[model samples]
Target: MSSNSPSSPLRVLVVIASSRPGRLAPAVAEWFVETTRRETERERMVVDVVDLGALALPFLDELEHPSTGVYAHEHTRAWSRRVADADAFVVVTPEYNYGMPAVLKNALDYLYEEWAWKPVAFVSYGNTSAGTRSVQMTKQVVTTLRMMPIGATVALRIGDSIEDGRVSERPMLGRAARQVVVELARVARALRPLHLAPATDGTTPGPVDGLSLSRVGEGDDVSELLVLQRSCWVEEAHANDTLDLAPLHETLADVQAWAKTWTVWAVRRHGRLVGAVRARAVGSTWEIGRLMVAPDQAGNGIGSWLLAVAEQHAPEEATTVALFTGKRSRRNIALYERAGFHLTAAPTTPDDAVLLTKSVAATTLA
Candidate 1:
């Protein structure tokens, strides 16, 4: 996504889990801001630091268990809301004698479903082990919470690196922080569907009536279809550094011709078009293309649902499915991967297009 997209920003919540005076949380947060500013030019994301020390959240104590849906305490409910609203998280922590601090653990323990399907990266500092213990322990907790823990981590050994309560030699820390931010951004975008679904009794609800799938045709609904295409192309143009409406308008004739030979579906929700997919039988393969969704309607499992429907409609003689996306569309690439497509080749154009394909049984039923 382009940094300048005029949508609601991707919210990054940096949680400072230390309450100690003169601690390294501020320096760590600064490092994060600096690194992220340089690495991500996309203005679509906004990072906010949540200082747990300043919040003075009390140790967990309640009349009921956290998993029981009885969060009576005001702080617990407020914190849970904050955690739920965030798209991604970074925990800045200090190692306390080979374990994460009790305060941090308690903070995490106060919520259950709020943390699921999100992405988390860590910034740690310590004297001996450099908070490696805290990182490991925190990973275990985050895994149980079902959040994706990214590969990048920042660890600072503060023995000689701290001068007058300020971090010295920040270049290394900056690099590490940048890596964490980039990976977190990637994973966060990948997990958007999982994160955006409404929390139920621990299960995602089946398709609702307004969100049902329907085939697209000349006589079929076209209003929502046009909106979805417009939104998707707008975002694509912004991210791929191309002229808006050029590829889309140019592809109209191709799209119409292809639609004649393909089964196209317009995904609708509440009587509005949210997404579209076209699957055409090419040789022995079912070529899926023009998979687009409204920017506001993305991250809500609509794309996956449309893909599933398209797969079910593939011709019985089809052997595989294939599609292409721009190299800059990292989110689309990851989604296609999750849906069982594998990268087939590098980009042949200057725009660096990525080709992906998925194998299917030739005799499979539609």
Candidate 2:
């Protein structure tokens, strides 16, 4: 999110909220982006435009609601990714019978957490109301989804601000557009910490910000964990020169069964499952398995922190903690080594993998 750095260029997604033929939303959105270009560049902001008309999203067709984020269709997934990638948003719209457009509402209803902890601004054009009513109606819905709507807005009078179906090049509106971008950037940076999970009563703070760790439960967490496993082990499959990694092929049922037996912990960022590791005590040794981190989050020290969490929860009677990885997974090996684990003679280990262990007494397992 926010281009890998909280202080990096702000990603502002401008949404064109009208889908009707010859709609003015595109022209309005174009004007907003162009007018704000100078301030955005000066403030290290990046602007991207999304046209609801071109996107052609149907009325909330997914069986599961946006709250679950279990997107069943490709369109929903694509939309979710785009929204999640942005740190802020701007909507350009026209009044629809004194409310927001149906297309805009539909697009907003397609995802949930992706909209959380971000700032949004609006530019509205209409007859008597100048689309201010539409903006008010949208703010209610966006607020319920956890988006922060700024005070800075641009409301256009179609009768005065339009010439030839486009916004007239007016200095007043250009200045207003700049204000919207500036206000959005300020609010977004202020709200950035809300996206991060600081220390909680029972949970230890992670290495980086925005991490929440918890035991795996019977919910969408299992489904998401199953997905994370398949994704994180692609490198393991490649390194071992085989597609035979269990994590790469484990089904939902397999994961569910294991959760019933092992103490499985997961790491979530903004409600997305980003990393996980599971372990169980076996004959004086705590056997840790299935260490995983989302590909984009692999280098963020999440895997190491998750390992520490597993160790911290290990049975006190266990003498050592152990895990296994593909022998060629040098990255994983190196991480374990730095954590004070080392390879040992594991006669039961599979041919393509090696067992690694660290004495529980030597670790901070409290």
Candidate 3:
């Protein structure tokens, strides 16, 4: 996991798939990126342009299967990392003999797991067929990698859509390009959980049975966390006998702001965001907050499991771990008590809230 702030943008990589000396792939890619710049920024996406002509990957030379992940050359490793880091991909390609360029296929063949469970959009250009056949051939290969090929695409006929070696400026063409990116973003986000949490083969220890836990990363969306916090805090309002609560009232912007300073962990079960917790070392004490589990997922020991996971992330210098809850929220207090926390007096806490603390040997946690 990359451990990026929850509000970080989706990483959309634009790939120019022609390596010939005088090729129009780069121009087409640039036009698409510029055409969709406004929507990309509005949707909180980050675009990175990758020109395969500059990458210079040779024909497949590794002896091992790509799934084994053992690359014999530095070029393969570099390409692997680039593709792995992307949340979604847009391949700008030109038809070659009515099929995708061999270089594009070679690039796709360089890695296995890195490409799975992500969305791919295509902007294809060529003659009469407008490169639709190339897209069809590429779709067959991409599906084998578990990459979803979206229905929305940009198809440009070289003669009709290009002018002076550049894609012509036209409102309808720009709109089509923007629509492809918009739909790609939608599918990218929708399929993010699958990309984040792959099916484990039961060899490694996890937070709980059937639950996958990992550090939150840059491309992870915080909208789900905001909704989970509000849903979980409603119970606290009833128990505490007051409507004034930070979690209950914190806007999405507020949550995003706090996420920057906190090292957060997200928990999932079967591809659903089920729980999350954030912790940061405050002086010698580790402060843990925003611990939550979906309402329907409560009472399955997820809260306790998540607390243990959060504590494991505490800093070495921290001798104490602390958290706060509504003063009258007995259920929360009881849960904390079972995890070795004790109610403590704090002058800085609001009258309606109570702080809890637990001492742990710094050496052990370190």
Candidate 4:
């Protein structure tokens, strides 16, 4: 798991949930394999794909609870093993009414811990929204299972890209696919250590002392909160090997305003301001905007402590908690994944950051 060591090949499970023959999964899967082979070969990483459509998985409804570790059905157990064995996953799905198909959701629900601590990406296709809604919904569910969904999603808009039952390759689509592959590689590399870490017993730890979670409001810690902002951006720069601090300072006011409306944790270590995290409430969902720890205190587990406090505070109101990180912040991204945030299908535009989220009530802490 050392960053410098020659890591094992990445076992990728490509789930094609759509049953329709002319659906976009074939083209999307092909694109993923082609692009992934090229990029992984350059990195000396092996890659493999599993087509779920060919697995013939049945709709979920059975005699046993997945969380209890008893899978009664044969197909369910097989699917669980497939999921458990893989190093990462890529879900090729077709959008249906601003959400993913029922079959896909059912497949995911069939297994709990088998999917934990792994990385996932999406290849989505649909009309107007281009499966953005489906991606959003899927992200919430995956996070509940403690999976790391890396930024780098491929979304294909219908009509403009389909021809005679085949999805014609657009140059732009290929480029996006390549980007997703590259990002997935980075995420897999980052999570390898955690994947190899010792498993935790099923017990949630108590919240840290002096760090309480409350709804963000007036008179809360502001300057103390600024430290998190600085820490996240500084760490982001260091991870990327860049030194631009302008964006870190420029977004202060905006982030502060965001804190006022959402739940923000004031992380006090030994009764002194050290770090903080601010999550904004958007509709029924909450997005974590600023999660930072003082640079000098990062490895001391302050960030992880703050994140646990925030998750405990998030569940009663919001359906999910989402956040974005810089593509280059390898450590931060892995930390977020370990905390149960999953990546969704959102293009990482120069200004549009990488998005990650977890379902509030659906996820458990251990």
Maximum-TM-score candidate? 2
Tell me the lDDT of model 4 at 274.
67
Clash pairs (backbone) in predicted model 1: 3-42, 3-43
Lowest lDDT sum, 10 consecutive residues, model 1, at 198-207
lDDT of 2 by residue, 1-366 (tens): 233335567778999999999899898888888888889998788888999999998788988666645556668767876786688999998999989999999999987766887889999999999999999999999999888999999999999999998899999999999999889989987876544322221354554566677887755489998888898888788878899878878899998989888888888887788988888999999999898989988655577567766766667798898999888887687556645677898789899888998898766411
Question: How far off is residue 19 in model 1, in Å?
Answer: 1.1
Candidate ordering by TM-score (highest first): 2, 3, 1, 4
TM-score of each: 0.53, 0.60, 0.58, 0.51
lDDT per residue as tens, model 1, 1-366: 111111345678899988888778788777667667856556456787898888778888766655433455567656765676677899988998888977788888887656777899998889888888998999999888777889999888888566767667577777887788788888877676554422211123222335645677764655445545766877777767775444456444545555567788775666677777888888987878778877776654566556655665667777788888876776676556545577786555335578888877511211
lDDT of 4 by residue, 61-165 (tens): 666566533455557656655665566788888888888988788888887756766689998888898887898999999999878888888887777776775
User: Residues 47-109, candidate 3, lDDT per residue (tens digit)?
Assistant: 989999899899999886876555667687677767766889999999899799999999999
Q: Give the candidate number with the greatest lDDT.
A: 2
Worst 10 residues of 2 by lDDT: 193-202
Instruction: Tell me the alpha-carbon RMSD of every candidate.
Output: 17.6, 13.5, 17.0, 19.6
Q: If both were scored by lDDT, which would come out higher, candidate 1 or candidate 4?
A: 1
lDDT value for model 2: 0.80
